[model samples]
Target: MTKTAIVTGGGRGIGQAIVERLLQDGMNVVTCGRGAEPADLPEGAVWVQADVVTKDGIDAIMKAAGRVDVLVNNAGVQVEKSVADSTDADYDLVMDVNCRGVFNMCRAVLPQMSETGGSTVNIGSISGMVSDPSMALYNASKAFVHGLTRSIAVDHGPKVRCNAIRPGWIMTAMAEDGFALANDPKAAMADALARHPVGRFGEPGDIAKIVSWLASDEAPYVTGECITVDGGMTAASPLNPGLF
Candidate 1:
């Protein structure tokens, strides 16, 4: 029988890739995002219009699509602000969407998962383990995802297994635009490649494959683990900050 998976932020970027992957794997995928739904979603993929930061939205999604075997908490936004520039509103916005959003999804879904004992992969970031300039809020938010994964694995074990995947710089539309706006996008991307031990940046497929493996019996022994799939960038950190 096919499985059921719910992935937030599935409208675009890494989340969209993951949603497509799960559908290709012959599972039912329920995806949600803020405001609009993807027009080109997979035939088997269900798109729900919802805001992850609110409890009512979370409830609506979970109630409409029941029994999820895999829950990917992939909805998040990065706030580029230094300590001096950050305000209370900025901090609240970051935590509310990235951290609290994950919590609400888990709470909405965990009861069903606890009984069935499935898998959950939280899309954390390498920033969760490390840090970057002007990204303290995003970094901290990802750290919360890692901590939350550990908590779920510990509390719901023998039934549910929770793991986190910390991704490096992934090539996506938003990232592409950001790089371009930063001046000399290709050079910037190339510079990043030089610093990374693997000598290249990552793609969405890189993360999607790892996530699929973690959710399968192939990684049965894995739980409460924060796996970094950054192409060896996290392997050594005497690396460059200019490209980060």
Candidate 2:
């Protein structure tokens, strides 16, 4: 039987890559986004116009994906501000999409998943494991995700496996926007690239491939784990000299 998978925020970037990868793996892919469906979404993928933070939105997605074997919680937003500069609105929006959205989707889907042995792959960030300056709210939100992923594994275990992927700096539109906001985009990009020992920043496909493994029978024993896909950015110490 063909399994159905639902991915949130699948219109672009890492989520889009994941949707494409899963379709290549031969699953029926249904994805959701808050805006009108993108013109370039993968040919075989189903796109639902919905948000993951609201009950109505979750309902709409679940309705589209009548029976889900895998759920990828990829919808997220970040506010580029320090705690002192962040507004209350920032706090609400960050938590609503990053934390509450995951909770809502899992709550709505886990019961059905529990019946037939499924998996959940949440797209967290390296920010969850380490602090990034001016990203305190986004950091905290991802930390919440890591914690919730573990709890879901403990509670719904022996069947449903839940895990998170913490990706490094991928060259997504969002990351490009971050660079554009810097005082010197070229220097900023070079500095960020130097941090990755691999000599290149990550691509969305790097993370998508791992999500494919963890959600499949290949990783049956992998649950409650937060896999870091950062191209060795976090493995190196800042003190390392330029090894050319």
Candidate 3:
């Protein structure tokens, strides 16, 4: 029997990569995003147009994908604001999509998953582990995801496996916008690269490959872990240029 997988926010970026990789693995892939399907979405995967921020949206996903063998909670939003400048609306938007969205998806899918044994891979961030300037709400929301990942693994283990992947700085559309906002995009890119020991930013396929492996039977014993897929960014010391 072919397994089924659902990846949220899969129209582009890391989500799209995960969807494509899963399709290559021969799993039945279903992807969803808030808006219309992008032209770049992989051909074989099914596209379900829905947002992860609301119960109805997740329910729509469950209705379209029955008996999900794998669930990838990849939908997220980032609000670049300081703790003092952040507003309730900012918190609401970030938390609704990043934290509550994952919770709702797991709540909806775990029962069926428990019956047959499945994997839940949440796309977390390095922000959850470390703080950055003007990213208070975004950092906090990802922390919620990390903590929730552990709790779910503890609560539903031996049947449903739950884990998270913390991607460092993938070259996604969001990261490009961040780079373009800088005063000197070239210099900014160089500075970002220097921070990682690999001397390069991650590609979406870097994350997609790990997600595919985690969802496979080969990783049956792995659960409740937040794997960091950064190019040694977190491992390198900011003050030690020689470390790299």
Candidate 4:
């Protein structure tokens, strides 16, 4: 079947990569972001400017797309601050965008998808599984995503299949900034590259490929699972450090 997919936060980075991949795979794609759509978006996909954090915005996205077979909840934010330094508003913003945004989109799309049983891929983060020093808000929000994925898979099974993709250091702007934080962006990237047992950080395409597979018939038997794509960062231990 030539399926249609709705990708949230699809203007750039990982979401943009997912949108392109789905289109390349011959799926009709509807991509949305908080900012304006890109100028030269792929042919098979349409763009919308909508906030995933709001009910009305989500409703508008689904209404335009219609009967989505795949929903990739790839919208999220990063807040790099100590818990003590962060404010309640900052926490709420992160929760609203990262956690609540996914919820709104999923809840809105589920009814239509339930009729034919669709697939959902939530874009989670390694920060949730492994605590980072200065990213408490983002970490908690992603942890919520993982838990929500499991719950959805269990509750909506025999119809809808839900899963999460926890990405490591992918070469998106997010990673670029982390690199820039050091004296040399190139050196920081090199450091991460050395850390991955595979000897490289991931491309957005890496996560996109995994999510695409999960949303297709190939992954019919899979549900309620979090597949980590962190180059085994979480798997490495004190005694068994990965590549670095």
- The lDDT per prediction is 0.85, 0.92, 0.90, 0.86
Score candidate 4 by lDDT: 0.86
Q: Which regions of candidate 3 are displaced past 4 Å?
A: 180-183, 240-244
Cα lDDT tens digits for candidate 2, 136-180: 899999999999999999999987999999998889986786677
Most accurate candidate by lDDT = 2
Q: Tell me the spans in candidate 4 whose CA falls farther than 4 Å from its real position.
A: 179-188, 239-244
TM-score sort, best first: 2, 3, 4, 1
For candidate 3, what's the RMSD?
A: 1.6
Kindly list the per-residue Cα lDDT of model 3 for residues 1-244, writing each as its tens digit.
8999999999889999999999999999989998988988898988888988777788889888887999999988888788899999998999899988998998998888888889999999998998765789989988999999999999998999999999988999877866775679898788878788887899999999999999999999999999999999899766645444
Write candidate 4's Cα lDDT for 1-244 as tens digits.
6889999988888998999999888899998888877886767688888898877788789887888899999988877777999998999899999999999988987887778889999999998888765788988999999999999999888899999999999988877655565667676566566667777678899999999899889988999999999987667654434343
Order of the predicted models by lDDT, top scorer first: 2, 3, 4, 1
lDDT of 1 by residue, 18-128 (tens): 988888887888999886777877678888999888988898788767878888999888777777899999999999999999999888888998898789999999889
Q: Is candidate 1 or 4 superior in TM-score?
A: 4
Alpha carbon RMSD to native, model 1? 2.7
Clashes of each: 1, 0, 0, 0
